[model samples]
Target: MEFDISWILMGFPAAFVLGWLASRFDLRQLRRENRSAPKAYFKGLNFLLNEQQDKAIDAFIEAVQNDPDTAELHFALGNLFRRRGEYSRAVRVHEHLLSRADISKPERERAQHALALDFMKAGLLDRAEDALARLEHTPYENEARLSRLAIYERAHDWPQAVQIARLMHSHNQGDYSVRIAHYLCEQALGQQAQGQLDAAKDLLQQAQSEAPHAPRPRIELAHLQHKSGDPVQALGSLMALASVSPSSVPLVAPLMLELVKTDKRKPQVRALLVANYHSSPSLDVMQSLVQLDEFARVENADGPVGRDWYVEHLRHEPSLVAAGRWLAQETLSHEEHHPAVQRALDNAAKPLTRYRCAACGFEARQHFWQCPGCQSWDSYPPRRVEEQ
Candidate 1:
């Protein structure tokens, strides 16, 4: 320990210079990192806009690695993965965002929604349902509920569908009464198929109570009544159908004719059909009238004046179906070849009689409340293809 005050004083400035140099190095490193993150992000965006998804994904992954706390970049990457059908990667990216302690509340909810979508698009409905349930009360609540409704419908979970529909109805999201009615009717059909006749009847009645103006409830209820040895009630339901849903009168015309034949309510049934025909004339109703008139003539040697209503319908609409029916009933000079000619005409008119979906242009021989091809509700118009 000789006197060393000068050496100690020299060491202080050297230490100060070293500390300043170290601080400068740290700032330069931070700047380079900040610049690298943006470069990779912009590169990813450029690739995404060019439809070069694979390169975009690589660039995004690099950016995420460079700056892992970037929630926005993670979200974009997750969506990109989901769009590319890489559900596992998408789920991981979204879940990673969720695990971040620094993420904001809104961002956490957004990541949850993205994760739910990943499950949904991957067809993992059960997982998607649980994920969607967690989004209630958030900004994504209504959209989550809508997706949930669709999922329950596809799963044939009528009770769940009804619950969501009622919730949506109460919130004024959209009028769900008709949708609720259809769900009840679907449940009724399921019960009926399983030999639960009483349960089926109860469900159909509930469906009717839910939507009195809907046609399916009344039409299906009549089928149950007819099966239960109550032709009068069955006929009454159909009569109610004619008044409430005149456009659907054609669908049940043949059923009404059968009831009239069995129950001998010819006068009443004829009047109902006539009134409906005048309101909305259709080939189905017109054919039923001809059947009734032809049967009446054979039974009582008299029938309505418009037995040739087909000939009259042609006067206004030029309906090929009407023409075919009229020709089939007439006698030709070449009577032996008339069967061949009639067969050709009837076969040609069959497609015109089919129902067509207005939304998707899918045609079917039978009417559907929901189009099987497009999965759209009320897509098929009540009128047949020829009329439409």
Candidate 2:
């Protein structure tokens, strides 16, 4: 049969009209969807601003569902979940983002970082370490390395801490010399505990070299030397420490007193103690001097006698501790009540003898290089609480 050209011409306009109507319908639907996504997002933002987290999360979920390809929405949802302590949900959201191959490079790295944060917050340390390790050489490298360093420190993995610290130092991230020295000192302590004396000494020496002005390495080295039955080296280390870091002399005062059996160094030690005491007037250094003087009185008549150091300290500072020490040796007019007064004075001075953390104000009977409360290194000053 022959086709009618009129029929073909009639069908063209009809199809064109139908196609126009369909296109209009699709455009309207697309506009509705686009409007709904933003509406949901803005609603979630409003809820978040009002601190209604539950409603905000619901709105965010609705927005994400409507626009699943919105990477920012996914990030916001994941961060919210993490903030709310729903680490599993946060991890799932970030992992889903990572699974999608359509995301850009920066987005992918951001997702990885968020995923690592999720693992860290969930206390999955090994998984967190793995995730953070993948971020090396990325823009987030420094932050990841610092987090790993903290993890190593919290785990007492001093060797790993040292490694990361050296890397950060080499990269010019910050001056980590003191921190590296601390890590080496920690490693030396572990070695010393295991009876590896020589290895411990070597590590301590390396630590001292790393931070010449830091007092811990020298102090620890002196301890190791003393333990190895080498009083001469121990005295030398302490004496060098007094020269390098004179403010730390109080920490080594008792150790200096222990070296009195090496009588040849006694004059030098007494002079060292006197110089430190005169310069800083530390109660600890004064106590060491008094002890040395007590020993000296036994040998020669011309040696200094009694608790005159306490009187001199009182002359410098109106210290209750000095007064108590002076009263202990003084012959009071009312001798019967002296014991009661002394007991009261000792009780009152007990708190002053404690070491306080400069960062967290945590008081301890003994000094800590790291605060037990805040875990900050070198938080405690060398001086006692009263002195501080």
lDDT of 2 at 290: 80
Backbone clashes in model 1, listed as residue pairs: none
Give stretches of model 1 more than 4 Å off. 1-16, 298-307, 334-340
- Candidate 2's TM-score reads 0.94
The best candidate in terms of TM-score: 2
Go through the candidates in order and give each one's C-alpha lDDT.
0.90, 0.92
The per-residue C-alpha lDDT of model 1 at residue 95 equals: 91
- The clash number for model 1 is 0
> Taking the tens digit of each residue's C-alpha lDDT, what string does model 1 give over 291-370?
88877653333323445688768877879888988887787798999999889989989999999999999999998988
In model 2, which residue pairs have backbone atoms overlapping below 3 Å? Answer: none
| True-structure RMSD, every candidate | 2.5, 2.2
